[model samples]
Target: MAGSIEIAGLGKTYREPVLDGLDLTIGGGVFALLGPNGAGKTTLVSILTTLIRPSTGSAHILGVDVVREPGAVRQLIAATGQNTTLDEYLTGRENLVMFGRLRGLGRRSRGRADELLAQFGLEQAGPRMVSTYSGGMRRRLDLAASLVTQPAVLFLDEPTTGLDPVARRSVWSDVRRLADDGTTVFLTTQTLDEAEALADRIAVLRAGRIVADGTVAELTATVGGQRLVLLDHDGTEVRSIDTDGTAASLDAALGAVPDAERALRATLRSPTLDDAFVALTQSATDHQEAVA
Candidate 1:
């Protein structure tokens, strides 16, 4: 069966191809598209959200073709871009209620606004003008506005781009709660930490194509297995030895370390998403250069 968000042979071109023969399938959960700048992440979101049509290929949200039935697709999905879409002059609650009314919620708009304000932990700030809200608060309100209609799929394009660590984690919690509630969140971000923290599955886009796709552990394993690191008394890394994460491999690595007792301690470290991302994207770049 097709996933909640499906793309087949997806391509988009402007002067040059931004997305090339892309294909992806995301089931109901937090699915992240990770890539560097100009990797066609926003282009894909635009196509899927019906903001723009693709040059080729098909995209569907919950079985509704975005190209053929954009109106239907719009009803099933909502998107929050990098910039806030809330009205600064209006109260947080007012912004949500406005969105609700735009969605034709009628008298239920206020009720839904209250529900979202409370859900996003903005009950206290809901009555204040958006201009007075903190960056994090505004972001939460923007997200809440997107959920006023309870979309099946929520597209978040770099949801936490310019926030401090605390604020980013706050948004991360909100996203987790939404996914837990069965909302299929399609998140696009360049930050590896964000993807590692939020995504149930991640696809790495390089240039215009997906180079890797898998769970966090799976992608990390692609770069390499566990590593054994020797640390000095000051907690500085003395040496790093690569291992296959097996007992025999670790034993061999340790046996090869000269004067191992001199080291204060040793630790096993697994390959992180950052390692996988750098390795995968660099390999893609090398391959593209060779092809050219």
Candidate 2:
């Protein structure tokens, strides 16, 4: 079974505060953390993964206290950071085998290596040196290496940073499969599209705090309701209006415009996750600037 995460009053600091009284509860599913650069996403991940200590408060992963039982928490979780950690001199298959060996897989190491290679669609390139692999291939190998023991909880920080569309979708498929099999996936990514597509829930981090947390629909509704997009007869840009999800609101918006009769088409659309992210982060930034 996968694990749940509980954090309360978590705070971290160095020359400046990174996280401040952050509280969260994440269960067995894909939970994505979204934030801009320097929003303390990496700091939170490091603290939760047991790589760094929190300045105050407490955290637990899979019911194991992160501070009190770092080793036990480490045993239940796997992490793949933004940077590549694979050895360029080693083959993809060899890397997996090496990880399995390090994890004490012993006699079953090679079998486990083969399984991950096949699972990640790297079987054909298993024998190829990591130096010869492309960026996407190396990413797959890195992720495969992290899953050598099939951890109950997985932490991925920007897992698909440089991947192409097809490769990104490939990784997304793997993530969905892992979650379907009952693994709790904690992911941080800059791509709102990826979060919208993969995350069962999302939390927006800003200014060392979680500004918002919920399903995509819930978050999007916070910025505003749905939207109405209109196109002109010449297929040129017309206007987009924030809507209240009522047919009357849509009609009123279009009706209020002088060129309503000349409109070629009108579409009522729900605000996208990206829209919510922008609105929330911008609000956070504006609030900070005003206070400063």
Candidate 3:
């Protein structure tokens, strides 16, 4: 277990309950927490990062009890929140060095920070005030700050919330790099595509509880309907199918078009992660409504 997180019967409430006995366990490697807004994803991140105490239950980071030994857990984890809190007056490089110093890595070289600046494509912006940096640049710098300590675990809350495609892609590369270096990455994002691309496994959180948890393919296969695909080798100018999917129905449709056999091929594949997200979120919404 290079880096591990075990949350059991975790609960949180502020006026109304946010979590209800949510449980999760992860050790090492990149894991994605996928959810929509108001789904308690941030709440889970806050507690797991030791920013706040849970209402009940226990959470362990790197085998250290978060509630009983917060300091020790903090030592093993770093979080890059959605909001970038870089000092406006400080240059990007200055901020990174400041963080590295705070981590008590003073004697250690800041050559790593310089390399990170270049790696994040912020070399030109290194000397500029955080106020002068673009949203994407500041986001990258915030992420860079988190890596100064080389923590065992890193929590990223929607790391690409406010970035362009190019900048977001660059940030994604950095995330992969960190995971490759043996850092256990806990990420939350609204972009299903992002989760599917990077996460070795994904846990869907809704109403502060994990409604679905598994590898992208596994979760998709849970609620994802059997996909029936028809390949038209003729490259027909127009093609359509009935909305209802049934073996008998498809067989009838194919039989009616027997003459088109040479140009048509049909196959079935399981559902995709995108479909799982929608299904999980919708189910959560229904649960919330019933609770209310």
Find the candidate with the highest lDDT and give its number: 1
Assess each prediction's global lDDT (C-alpha) against the native: 0.88, 0.87, 0.81
In candidate 3, position 124 carries an lDDT of 93
Sorting all predicted structures by TM-score, with the top scorer first, yields: 2, 1, 3
> What is the TM-score (0 to 1) of candidate 2?
0.86
Count of clashing residue pairs in every prediction: 0, 0, 0
Residue-by-residue lDDT tens digits, candidate 2, 1-292: 4339999999999989989999898977899999999899889999999999999999999789999999999899999987557988989989999999988899798999999899889999999999999999989999998889888899999899899999999999999999999999999998899999999999999889999999988898886767766677776546666668777887787775565444457776777777778777777666334322
Backbone clashes in model 2, listed as residue pairs: none
Q: Is candidate 2 or candidate 3 better by TM-score?
A: 2
Candidate 3: minimum summed lDDT over ten consecutive residues — where? 235-244
- What shift in Å separates residue 61 of candidate 3 from its native position after superposition? 0.4
* Candidate 2 global CA lDDT score: 0.87
Candidate 2, residue 229: the lDDT equals: 68
Rank by lDDT, highest first.
1, 2, 3
